[model samples]
Target: MIEANKLKMQLKCPMPKLDFDVITLGHGSGGVLTNKLLDSGVFKILSNPLLDERHDGALINLEGKTAFSTDSFLVSPIFFPGGNIGELAVNGTVNDLAMCGAIPKYLSLSFIIEEGLTMTEFWEILLSIKCACEKAGVTVVTGDTKVVEKGKGDKIFINTSGIGSIHPKANISSKRIKIGDKIIISGNIASHGMAIMSVREGLQFESEILSDTTNLNHTISALLDTFGDGIHLLTDPTRGGIATVFKEIAQHNGVGIDIFQSELPIDNQVSNACELLGLDPIYVANEGLFISFVDESIADDFLKTLRNDDNGTQANIIGTVVETHPKQVIMESVIGGKRVVNMLPGEQLPRIC
Candidate 1:
């Protein structure tokens, strides 16, 4: 009876597999396995006519002036509080074109997958990419996949190339930003960066923080429909945050920009997280927000219209371009003092999208 019990225990013990249900180098070798991976996984979800063609490259037609942008997403932790690298890649590329007053249309997705990553995780990311494209009113018309040896690369990296057409009357440019131009922000800043940090640090707060990782193309298109060329400049504050965007445009237009710290929008939870980390929310990142420079005369009209949009409900006119301090960003402290805001000196958060 003792020997029978011992044999049953040995049968129930867990053991490591000689092989795994994970990605392997052969999946990228353009052989039978490559076709199976593409056929059974990626293409199964992202089914569109152009991608179905399976040509070496996608053939597309663009009318009028087309703006093309490409971005590579290498955010650490693959998945974060609000989004993963897949959604970030899609939204990031779409926002880049939107900043130029373009309507995003199609995209090409490419991936670098590390060996030993689970196929289940890869398929989840693929589905994420598909959903993001649909939400943005864009299509993933082409894609490529490559596999790297384990330990040499992260679990995954994504590269997205987007094509969009410039609006006919859209003459957005830094040169169009004059001293009288007003700066309007879409929503509360720093939620995205703080959300990522919150997950990484495992901090407990009174409230939960979620990343604002979403697409803004619809709202931006509405802005174009409302104010056409009255919009002077548009930018999404991502890596270096609102302060960095202000400094770049201020310098590019050779004008001074002043923002009231009291007017800056921030979430209470994100604020607490920032304070605990000794980080300033202004220099953090954002995913679903943007800054608009518009003519001073129509600033109120633009603000009201933007407020009606789902994402821009928290919109605020944070600052205006001024003639006093050329090529610099000045922030008016809540305590009634002014200070210069510059681009982030170095990498504040590494592997942050």
Candidate 2:
């Protein structure tokens, strides 16, 4: 019964309350209060050897070619069906480095908070950052915070900079793409953009469309393990989507791309949503997907590899590189004709990411 009595006493111990319930300008003033905020909140949640060093910048040892990337998250409706801004911020940067064939290592986060933002909400986002880092096997080694006037900002904006070590066998790059390289898309398109658009425009369809926001690090790693440098290129089609990305790739690599409409992976609900909104799925945003260009000889090997992955079950060989229409993307119509898929004349969906 002594153990039971000890458990009861431990439960009775009260937790300490935050000294200030809401953040103020002073928290960003680099004074005593700022240190308190970091110690009590950021440090408490993101406990790690590098972060606890308490230096102005983190000292990390990365050998070989290191990939570095940074991004800022201003996604509207910060909280979405499948994820919040915190997860998006971490995943986006992590995936950027992964696209470069890097093993993600560390991240630096900064928050731009609006005055009067709830303390609870701020802590919630921090906790999510921690969780995303854990899931991706990365760390937030350093950070900064600033408070803006209420009207000058949304509730909060997050910026993350990531560092990773590129594998020696990763020969993927826009310039490395060659003629006859096959293009493989990781999964269904337009879900993320449609998810945001549907909620923002108050359009209800047959079913709920959730954002496909996810980290592609593991999937890419699996491919690299199997195919190594045979994978010629990797890219996540974000703001401008696959069409725009394909056009840029064709232009940069001096190759023409032919995408087949019949091979495109479009969910029925997403296709219907696009039809109702006068949108095209190929030109919509996707957070959890990526495009891979592989040597035609091993294309099936890569496809089988991705198919074995849970997130890439819908992976499909969507197109091929051609020499005829150099620096252009041509889409073969379902009925058996071809059309030039130019870089979008203008933005189709703004701020969807």
Candidate 3:
């Protein structure tokens, strides 16, 4: 009986040096396995001046006014139709800073790579990041990398932090918003969310859906040149889409908002997809788009200015701030009915950003 118990104990023990084939949850436990993955995969390739310090947060020194923002990308299927995790990470951070009326300048990238991921795919993602940085005219000054044991993580995840200089005279914030302000969207809604949904669910359509994940700093700068302080609020409708964004702005400024459904610019394909999936296009995410609130008198000029730009071809005034329903967001439907658009109680799509 004692000999039998000893043999069973030996059988139950796990091999310490066993090789992993995929990522496991243990890799994310911040243990030895997680550290090994980071040290072996990402850190070796991306060692740089800013990242070499290995600090909890990067030390960023800048001149004049500065804006800082950080974002993590966990969109599934990492590689989507029009963009991937790499491009999304860079653009996401850049746009965040720009939304604050900042001139995006530098970025720090950190990678959480899953074990068993192919080097070729990783290299491709890196290339995409390089291209995105070039397009945004920002330098990737620093970054960190870590790997997880097989089955311990998703395929790959990326986190990016960015710093930018706030453009002089570009005072934009929710606090500046007031009643009678006009709300303008840079372009169509729901494209990015639908694009990711199509890929994740293997849904094919007549026209290919592409993510609108591009840097908005240039278009924002153009608008700032013309509107400047008149632009009260500038925010990108990302994870929770337009409905959530309006609600946030309204709550922040202590005002009410009403949007006209008929005025929202949505692509036909996006509308069809949302209808089929029983998803509200208003609640879908948009990466390459933003909403601007400005004085009613400057609305026309703002619309014209946006329309003239390639990025704002579909720009339109979707709503207005009101003094009546403070801290509430309401929408006027196409059938002439008014309804409240509330914040999403829970996530509509997990890992969307």
Candidate 4:
């Protein structure tokens, strides 16, 4: 098991003493309490020139094409095995931009807090947001905060919007995918979902499962720098995992996807937990991993280059785009039998992102 200390960023910003121990409705009233919360918590930890201006929004310069994406996070257990909702909010949006072949630059953070939440909990989440922004080399330019009456909302919910300039060499699109293209998974699958399940379901394994939640912008930037247009497309299997992602792409692009069960990458502990729970790892969620569809000629080189990176040590060529079965996904079993891999019937795990 990865140490919890290793999985989480050490608190860099110390918690400041506040007048109130727990939040109240007044904290969201845009009055003195709200100002105190922002000044002592959010603004202090995520300080920057643009954010310090305290404007309704930020002005950023973008020369070429840009990518914009936003998402809301609502996990049952705000604090999970490997990460909390704060980092997940930042990473989820950052990754969405990265998959668009963009270098993430700035983010807007918004929070919905429950009235009874302790100030200490809010401070910890802010520190995590600060750490995540610093790690991704992105700044929090603007945001909003609101507090709801107890029982009206979850402990806390986060929404993040991100914008970035597209990489010059990147030519990514689902339409770019074609027959003979190779599909490569960035790393082991199913880690993030199982990590959350372990905590939510009170299931215990020999070794703790850690969420694979980290920024993938740097890894993607390096790949774009080296491979250029040799890379055809990029996608992350977040909520519905690899199977759902492949099925969506195939149906949308009128293409066929063929995968091998033996080639799929998964950590042993996570795989075991999935077995015990009767879950298919391929349908599980992931945070830090991505799928790269590249020209077949460079498949081996692409796989090698990705494996050399820290985030891609467990990378593998899991599948290929084919023409045999249009608009469908087929997986070859470990015993060499084949079957259709369909879209998820319904939500396998809810609030997983």
lDDT of each: 0.86, 0.85, 0.83, 0.90
lDDT of 1 by residue, 322-345 (tens): 999899899999999999999998
By TM-score, how accurate is candidate 2?
A: 0.92
As for TM-score, the candidate ahead, 1 or 3, is 1
Instruction: List, residue by residue over 105-139, the lDDT tens digit for candidate 3.
Output: 98988778787676556655765776677678887
**C-alpha lDDT of residue 293 in model 1:** 95
lDDT of 4 by residue, 115-191 (tens): 89888888877877777787888999999999999999988999999999999999989889989999999999999
With a 3 Å backbone cut-off (N, CA, C), the pairs that clash in candidate 2 are none
Error of 4 at 195 (Å): 0.3
Give RMSD to native, each candidate.
9.1, 5.8, 11.6, 1.7
Q: Ten residues in a row with the worst lDDT in model 4?
A: 1-10
lDDT of 2 by residue, 163-251 (tens): 99896678778887888999999999998999888888888876788888878898898889889989999999998789999999888
TM-score of each: 0.93, 0.92, 0.85, 0.97
Error of 2 at 83 (Å): 0.3
Candidate 2 Cα errors over 4 Å, as ranges = 1-16
Relative to the unseen true structure, what is the Cα RMSD of model 4?
1.7
